[model samples]
Target chain A: AQTVTQSQPEMSVQEAETVTLSCTYDTSESDYYLFWYKQPPSRQMILVIRQEAYKQQNATENRFSVNFQKAAKSFSLKISDSQLGDAAMYFCAYRKQYGNKLVFGAGTILRVKS
Target chain B: EAGVAQSPRYKIIEKRQSVAFWCNPISGHATLYWYQQILGQGPKLLIQFQNNGVVDDSQLPKDRFSAERLKGVDSTLKIQPAKLEDSAVYLCASSLDSGRLTDTQYFGPGTRLTVL
Candidate 1:
């Protein structure tokens, strides 16, 4: 079984500042994928970024980037130039390359302060 | 492209009652997923389907919950004798075939269920 863990329950960051949300996972599969999703109060789940285990280089989406350390089973999301729109519940997810089930972490509530 | 679609944005029912939710995946998506998201918690996979054929349902509570993707496009989930713990947001998501390692999933707005 694969499990994702987000140690932080909540995080706050000043607008335009940078913030990093930590995530860890336990998976026996050598090939898998990691993802970060954002859900605002509206309740829509939006994909923020994704990282492939085989790729040594991390994934980035404009202001969003990731620091993935496969050996340590660590994958953290970094949000640069955070804005008010970034305020939402963030989730860390894991999925095996050949599997369809996606395991998710408890989630972290991000609050962007102006 | 239109994202996943789920009906009944919110539902309120008493315990022991039956309820159902519907979902329509993206036009060409070959994989669909159903998840339960409890307040203050992350979403948990309830079931997954690949072109109307179930791929996984290990975590689903079969005793009271059932789901089907009859046509390989749209899906429905039903719960009978609902319990208080069944109160949660039900989300639907779709993605391209899992064979593509880079396939990303798109999610619906979700149906919020409250069992009284």
Candidate 2:
């Protein structure tokens, strides 16, 4: 079975600064997808960014970007110019290229300090 | 486009009580998913549906939980004789097409259930 691991339980970042959340996965399949989701107090899971395993170029969405290293099976999310709204529970998820199911990590709580 | 919709934003029940959750996926979406999220943990997929047919329910606790997506749009998840361990947030999500690799899943405001 495929498993995702998020090492950081909590992360603190100052407004206007940058923070990176680490994620690693174990998978035997060569083709897959990775995603980062943010869940605020409202309990809505919002998509932050996503990366395809076959793509060499990392995926970037506005202030959010992922450093995807396929060989090492590490996918890290970087949040630049962190704002107060960025404070949430961030989760890393994995999905097979041909599968609809997503396996998520434990999650890391991000706190943005003023 | 409008996102997924879930009813009864919050639900409370005692042990051995029955409860049900309702979900309406995004318009035209072909894939719907149900997830259970315990406090301080990531969401776990409970069941998945492609239209009105079940795609996966392997992780679902069939002994007590049941879910169905009839008419290929609206879905309902029922829990009979709920247990304290079932206290968690239930999230519903939908994707444009399960067969497309680039399709993103949109989530609804999850229903928080408290089994006292």
Candidate 3:
């Protein structure tokens, strides 16, 4: 069984500032994938970013980036130039390389202040 | 591309009642997934399917929950004698690969279920 954990229950960041959310997971599989999903008040789950376990270089999408530490089983999301649109509940997800099930963390509510 | 589609955006039912939700995955996607998202929590995988065959249903509360994907294009989830804790949003997602390595999954808006 795979489990994802997000330590931060809620996070606040000023507009144009930066913020990072922490995530950790327990997985016995050597190959897997990680993802970050954002859900706003509209209640739609949207993909934010993804990281492959085999890749040493972190993944970056425009203003979003991730620090993935495979050995430590740690993956974190970083938002630069944070904007109001970033305000939402963020989730850390894990999936085995050979299975289709995705294990998700509880989620961290992010508030972007102006 | 059209994202996954789910019907009955909202549903309210009393305890012990039965309800069903529908989902249409992205065209050509072989893998379909159903998830339960409780308020203030992340989505939990309830089931997974490859084409018309079920891949996994370990976390599904089978005592009252049932799901089917007849032709693999669209699927339906049902709950019988709903429990109060079943109050949550049911989400549907689709991926290009049936295997777990797919990093991208398109999700639907989800059907919010309320059991009173």
Give the candidate number with the greatest lDDT: 2
Candidate 1 Cα outliers beyond 4 Å, as residue runs: none
Fnat per model, in the order shown: 0.89, 0.87, 0.89
Q: Which 10-residue span in candidate 2 chain B carries the lowest summed lDDT?
A: B96-105
> What is the alpha-carbon lDDT of model 1 when measured against the actual structure?
0.94
| Tens digits of lDDT, candidate 1, A61-107 | 99999999999999999999999999999999998987777889999
Chain A TM-score, each candidate = 0.98, 0.99, 0.98
lDDT tens readout by residue for model 2, A1-114: 999999999999999999999999999999999999999989899999989999999999999999999999999999999999999999999999997899999999999999
* DockQ agreement of candidate 3 with the native complex: 0.77
Candidate 3 residue-wise lDDT at B60 = 94
Descending-TM-score candidate ranking: 2, 1, 3
C-alpha lDDT (0 to 100) for residue B53 of candidate 1? 91
How does chain B score by TM in each prediction? 0.98, 0.98, 0.95
Per-candidate iRMSD: 0.9, 0.7, 1.5
Colliding residue pairs in candidate 2 = none
- Model 1: pairs clashing at backbone N, Cα or C within 3 Å: none
DockQ of each: 0.86, 0.89, 0.77
lDDT of 3 by residue, B1-116 (tens): 78889999999999999999999998999999999999877899899998998889988999999999998789999999899999999999999876445547889999999999
In angstroms, the error of model 1 at A6 is: 0.4
